[model samples]
Target: MSQSKSLLANIGVQVVIAMIIGTAVGAFMGHSAAMFAPLGAIFINLIKMLVIPLVAVALISGAAGLGNSTNAGKVGFSTLAYFALTSALAVALALIMGEIFKPGVGIDVSSVEGMFSGEYASKGELPSFWATVTGMIPTNVFASLTNANILQILVFCLFFGLALSKQPKKNREPILQGVNTIVDAMVWMINCVMKIAPIGVFGLMAEAVGTFGFSALMVVFKLFLVFIAAILVFGFVIYPLLVQLFTKTSAKSFLVAMKKPQAVALSTASSMATLPVTMNTVENELGVRNATASFVLPLGATINMSGNAIYYGLVAVFFAQLFNIDLSMGAYVAIILTSTLGAVGQAGVPGPSFLVVAVLLAAGIPIEGLPLLFALDRIFDMIRTALNITGDAACAVIIDNIAIEASDLTESEVKQS
Candidate 1:
C-alpha cells in the first residue's frame, strides 16, 4: 500500500514538473532559454538513439511470439481498429478547432513565404496514400534497417510472425515461446534504461525553459490553445466514452491506472520512451492480460498517435489561412485524411508535425507558416505526448474489457448450453 501511494505521488510530481517546466520555458529570460535548450535536445536524443533497435527487435519478436495465427489476427485487427478510430477523431477535432479559432487571421504571411527554405523538400518525399499502402512490404531487410524504415520493419515483423504461426507445432511452438521471452527481456532492459528518466526530464525542462521565453509565444498562442483544448477533449472526454462503449469497464479505474504513465509521458514527451511504464500500468494495475498489453501498448506507442494527428490537421489549416489560401470542404477532408496517414508515417521523429506541415504546404497550402509554429512545438509536444499516452491507455482498457467480457459471456453461455 505504501509503495502504491509512493508511485501515485511520483506521478503527481511528474505532471507538476512538466507544467512548471513548459510554463517557465514559455516565460523565462531569452538567453537562459537558449543556454538550456541543449539539455532538452540531449535528453530527446538519448531516447531517440535507442528507438530504432528497440522498435525493430520488440516488433519483430512481438510478431514471432504470437504462437497461433488466429490469435495474431485477433490482436492485429483490434490494434489497427483502435488506431484508426482514435486517429480519425484527432483529425476531426483539430479541423474544428482550427476553423473556430482562425489562429492565422492576422499573422504576417511573409514570414512563411519569405523564409521558405529548400529543406522543406523532404516534406514531399512521401508517396500518395495508395503508394504508402503498397510499399508496406519491405524489399530489402538490411536496407530498411540502414534507413531506419519503420514501415518496412513493421511489414517484415508481420510476415515473419505469420510464417512462424503457420509452422508445424513441433517446429514453431518452442520458438514462439522463446521469442516471446526474449522480447519481454528486451523491454525489461529498456525499463532499466528508463531509470534515468528524472535526470533526463529535468535536463529537458531546464533547457527548454532557458531557450524559448514567453514573449515568443505570442505568435502561436492561438494554435497552442487549440491543441491544448483538443488534447483535453480527447484525453478526458472521448477516451472515457470509448472505454464505456466498448469495454463495459469502469473508465475511472482505467484513468487511475494511467496516472503514473501519463505523468512520465508529459515529462519525457516521448510515447515510445514511456512504453515500459505504460505496459506496467495496463497489465499490472489495470488487470489487462499480459498478452494483450504487450501486443497493444507497444504498437500504440509507435502508430496510434492521436495527438500528432490533431497537430498535423490543425497546423495544415493554420498554414493555409496564413497564406490566404481558402480550403474548400474537399480540401479540408483531404487534410484530415492525409494528416492522419502522415501522423502514423512520421511517428517517432523529433518535430514530426513540422514534416507533416511541410507535406501539407507542398500540396499548395503554404509551408512558410511553420516558423511561428516552430517556436512553440516543444511546448505543444509535451501536451501531445501526454494525450498520446492517455489514448494508448484508453485503448488498452477498452480492448481488455472487450476480451474479458467476451470470455465471461462465453463461459456463462457454455454453462447454460
Candidate 2:
C-alpha cells in the first residue's frame, strides 16, 4: 500500500492524471478551454529557453573532454554509425507498421480541408540537398544562437570544442570548467521547470482537445493509435532486446532505471530537456562508464533520433494516404533515407518532427496537410522524445561495453609482449 501511494505521487503519474482531466474538461467545456493555452505556452517557452545554451554547453563540454583527436574521432565515428543504423531501422519499422495499420484510411478529407492555410502551404519548400548540407555551417555564430538553428549551432560547437580539446590542459581547464558549470545550472533550470509539468501538460492537452474537439481528433484517430502502438513496441520490445544482445545488459533493469528520464521526456516532449536525466541514469543507475556516457549521450541528444525518423515515415505515409497520393516502392525508399538524414540534421531542434516537411516535399505529398498534422504534434512529440532518449541510453551502453572489451584485449596483448 505504501509503495503504491509513493508510485502515485511520482510526477509521471501526476502528468498522466492531469492529461485525463484536461481531456475530459476540454471535451465538456469546448472552446472555453482555450483559456488554458497561456499556461502551456509558458511552460513550452521555458523549455525552449534552455535549448540554445544547454545544447551548446553540453556539446562543447562533451567534445572538449575527448582527451585527444584520435579518441574523439573514434568515438565520433562509432556514435554516428549507431545513430544512423538505429534511425534507419526505426524508419523501416514505421513504414511497415503504417502499411499494416493504414492509419490515414477512411478519414474524411473535407473535414480537415478548412484547417489548411496559405501560410503553412508556402512554408513547405525544401532547399536542395546540397543547400541543406552547406546550410549547417553557419556564417555567423551569434546569428545561429539567436535564431536557434540547431544544425548550425552543432557545426560551430564541433569546431570550437575540437579546437579546445587540442589545447594544453593548463590553457583549456578553466574554459571547460566554465562550460560544465553552465550545464549544471541549465539542468537545475530544467528540474525547476519540471515541477510544473503536470499543470503544463494539463493546459496543453485542454487546449488541443478543446480547439480540435473530439471530432477532429477522430479524423486522425487511427494515425494516433498507430503511433502509440509503434512507440510501445519499440520502447518495450525492440530496445530492450537490442541492449541484451549487444551488451548483455538486463532489459528489465535498464528499463526500470530509464523510467524517470522517460517520464521527463514524455512530459516535456523535449529530448534536450531530458538530457541531464538521461546522462545521470546511464552513468549512476545503469553503470555505463562516464567517458562513454558523457561523449555519447550528449551527442545522442543532438543527433540520435530514431523516434523522429519513425515519425517521419509514418506521417509521410499518413499524409500520402490522406491526399490520395500513391507512393511507389522507390518513393518509400526515398522517405526512409530522407527521414534518417533529416533526423540527424534536425537534431537538438525543438519540434524536430517539423523537419519532416522536407520529407513530405521530397515524396511529393501536398504541403497543405501539414497544418492538420501540426494539430496533433504535441501528443506524438511526447512519446517520440521518450523513445529517442531511450535509444540514446542504449547506444551508450553498447559503446561502453565495446570499449571495455577492446581495452581488455589490448592489456592482454601488452602482457604477452
Top lDDT prediction, candidate number: 2
TM-score, each model? 0.84, 0.86
Query: 183 in model 2: Cα distance from truth in Å?
Result: 2.8
Per TM-score, the best of the predicted structures is 2
Residue pairs in collision within model 1: 25-209, 26-214, 32-210, 33-210, 33-211, 34-210, 34-211, 36-207, 112-368
Alpha carbon lDDT of residue 345, candidate 2?
A: 62
lDDT of 1 by residue, 244-308 (tens): 77775677877777777877777777787777778777877777776566566767886888988
Q: In model 2, where is the ten-residue run with the lowest total lDDT? A: 345-354
How far out, in Å, is residue 344 in model 1? Answer: 2.5
Candidate 1: misplaced stretches above 4 Å? Answer: 1-54, 60-71, 108-122, 404-417
Total backbone collisions, model 1: 9
List model 2 lDDT by residue over 207-263, tens digit each: 877886766557678888888888888888998998889886899999988888887
